[model samples]
Target chain A: MKNRVRYTFILPALILMTIIVAFPIIYNLYMSLHIWFVASGSGPHWNGLKNYIALLSDKRFWNSIRVTIIFTVGALGSEVLIGVLLALFFNRQFKGKDIIKTIFLFPIAATPVAVALIWGMMYNYDLGIINVLLKAIGLPPLLWLADPKWVIPALIITDAWQWTPLILLIVLSNLESLPTDPFESAKVDGANSLQVILYITLPMVKPAIIVAAMIRSIDAIKTFDLIYVMTQGGPDIASENLNLYIFNMGFSYFRMGMASTLAIVLFTIVMAVNVFLAVIRNRDVT
Target chain B: MSKSYIKTGLFYIGIAAITILPLIVFLWMFLTGLKTQMDNLAIPPKIIFSPTLQNFKSVFAQNNFLKYLFNSFIVAVFAVAISLLFGLPAAYAIARFKMHKIGLTLLIARMIPFISYLIPWFIIFRKLRLVDTYIALITTHLIITLPFIIWIMVNFFENVPISLEEAARIDGCSYFQVFVRILIPVVRNGIFTSSVLGFIFSWNQFLFSLILSGNRTMTVPVAVFKFISYEEINWGGLAAAATTITLPPLILTLFIQKHMIKGLTSGAVKG
Candidate 1:
């Protein structure tokens, strides 16, 4: 009776989950294997694995994949590095720490679309304050969005700005919870501050860092709003990561079939990465 | 002693700069929202000027942003309410039954790109004539809120002592009764945190509202996009819209900074 009740308790969420998430995934797969553009007002025509095969050779698809990798790595790498450093700096007892820490939480929770708009204005070539500040320092103004070379970096910078706080928060929390025995022992063993951090603190916080990195990487690869609002994958699709490309394929062009195929591919990549991270994380935990 | 004092002073300055760097952009945006178009674009940018309410007036009056704000509120609130109705029991079950697979499933749902669900949802919603309805917007917003609420509340439920519920069950109370009478009372803080975070996520959601919703149910984030066009950009209006959109989440984060941080970092710590 108790077991039955437990299963019953889970059933509602299961039903909603199936309807909201699982059903769409299956339907997304079904759409991917057919020609089902919504505007056509016709039923889907079955097309086996042809869509997947075609995506293999699609230059734009490959370009999006490449962009996703660069963007994810660039943003995730910098965020982890800078976040850890900031966490270290903030671990100390200091005046005004409470106020500064509270303020630091602002960007992590702010609306992404709004943040993107703010960044877009700040990156505008002629009217932006960034260029104004640059010229004040006797530097030439560069086009932030109009140039292909700068677009990915610009996006990465914005993402890092917003999310580095998350990494810092996680790391700082882990740092606070770390056992003090090792550090105390190390101090008595005549260890310097740098050596203690490298040997003792870093190892203790490795799991937190990895968790933070994986989370940031997943979120970074799926970034859409900031790109959609800031650049819309412009300058010849230079910053067209997989999410925006799939979005354009579905909504802008209404190529539902191709878009669904690409979305499935993106989903597979994300799930695979997630599974890999989970395996590693579980092993570390055990 | 003097050298160490100088070092501490330098560290404070560094921390202050690091803290302010990300926020300077937002500060600029807020200030720009209060400036006229000319003043916004003025060379060297205006350091000090008489702030104006013109941009806020234009966004609210011309863009029907207040309607969008209402739409956002409706979607976020209903979705979160529905999520709690469904998610609390599931989280309780998962926490008590060691249903790790179910938890993993919800995590995957949380991580799936919003686009993967978009095309199918758009098609289905269109077929049902649900497009542009708050029903469509609220249902899809559940995709974000449900998983988050379940995930956060699962951890919270785990921390609740099993003895309390066991005692309630032994007293001839039904499982549901125990859940309501004992678990809910004990986990009120968790429920509050989950609701606030869930509401914030739903309110800030962009992609679903962008693709699935139309003029009737546009959200604030999507509505702000109206200020930009191929022909011209309304910098002042856009900033004002952005500023307004950020206020609720900002204030929420400030009010519950500890819970928000703990909630956000829950997965990482337990990992």
Candidate 2:
């Protein structure tokens, strides 16, 4: 009876997780086996891996994968590099550290919707501040989301702006946690700031770096809000990511089976990245 | 001495500018919210516009703004509650037992691209006639909240030693008793952290609520999205609506700024 009751609390969560979380994941696989659309109506009709096969052949699918790679690498690269630098800069005790830390919290709590809106306005070609500033500086105004060439770069910048703080916060905490003995010894040896950081701090924070990289990469891979709001995978799907492609498939095109296939593919890719990280972490743990 | 001061001042300037750019833009939006459409659109950008309550008046008068607000509230609140209920015990299990695989899985669930599930779940919810319902909205919101709860709470629960619960057990408490009587108190910070993250994530969720919620159940994000469409973009109304939708979360963010910052990245970078 006691065991049963203990199970009660755990059971509800397990059941809910199974139903809500696990179910959609499982159902996506089931749906992916079909060649169905909105006309398939209530439940998707099975075509037994045809959708997956189609996804393999689809140019649109390949394009999305390429775009997703660019987005993932671009966003994660800046987030990690800039994040490490920002964390280091803020690590030293300084006046207004508390206030700066608080301000650094903006991108995290600033709703993606609002961030996208503000970015959208900033990226606007004509009346936006960016263009205005460019004009004032005697530089040519670049169309941020209009031209396909610059759209991805613009998104990368905005994404970096929003997420670097997240990585910075994480790495800063990790830096604070580092054993200071080595650093103190290094300082006693008259090592420079750059040498101390490069020699001691960097190596010590590897786990934190890995964790930050993993988390940021995951978030970057799944970016939907800023892209959806700012560009909607536009200027001819220049910014269409896997997530946006999935959104378009499901909502705009109503290709339920194809969308499920895309969703499952995205999930598989994310899992691969995660598994790779986990293996590295496990190796480190040993 | 002069060079050092110049460099220090430049560093401060750079940091401040980097941080303040978005704030200035957000302030512009807030200021636009307080301006008449004509004042808002003026060229040379009347950095000082004649403020008016007219936009707020029309926004509330025109849209079912409160209903949308209530929808956001309902979804955010219940989603937090449900995610906590589902997440806490699992988090507790992961913390005490070190169930690494399960923990990883939960994190992955939280991090998974949400848009992937939008249509698949939409069809299922429609089949069950649960689409656009509060149940659907709140449940769908679990996609955002539960993983956050699990991730945040796991770190908190991990920091708490199991010996306290062992003491409760030796005092003749059941496992549930230990959880209810002991673990909850020690992990209150974790609970608060998870709640804030959950609430914010739910509040910010767009794709699910957009497709899932019908006319009666529209959310602030989608409602803001509605202000711009094919026929004609209502630039003034859109900006006003964006500002209005953004204010509550921004205010809420400031109110809980400390917790919000700690909550967002603390788990991933444990000391």
Top TM-score prediction, candidate number: 1
Among all windows of 10 consecutive residues in model 2 chain A, the one with the lowest summed lDDT is: A1-10
- Per residue, candidate 1 scores C-alpha lDDT tens digits across A126-179 of 878777888889999989888999989998989999999889988998899988
As a whole number from 0 to 100, the lDDT of residue A109 in candidate 2 is 69
Q: For model 2, report the TM-score of its A chain.
A: 0.95
Model 1 residue A252 distance off true place after TM-score fit, in angstroms: 1.6
- Candidate 1 root-mean-square deviation in Å: 1.5
Deviation in angstroms for A181 in model 2?
2.0
Each candidate's root-mean-square deviation in Å?
Answer: 1.5, 2.6
Residue range with the least summed lDDT across 10 consecutive positions in model 2 chain B: B227-236
lDDT of 1 at A24: 95
Residue range B1-271, candidate 1, lDDT tens digits: 9999999989988988898986787798899899998887677778899899999998889877899999999999999999999999999999999998888777778678889888899999989998989988888899988988888889999999899888888899999899988899899998999899999999999999987788888898888776666314667888888899999998887767778877875653443
Place model 1 in a CAPRI quality band. Answer: medium
Clashing pairs in 1: none
After the best TM-score superposition of candidate 1, give how far the Cα of residue A142 lies from its true spot, in angstroms: 0.9
| Model 2 CA lDDT for position B96 | 70
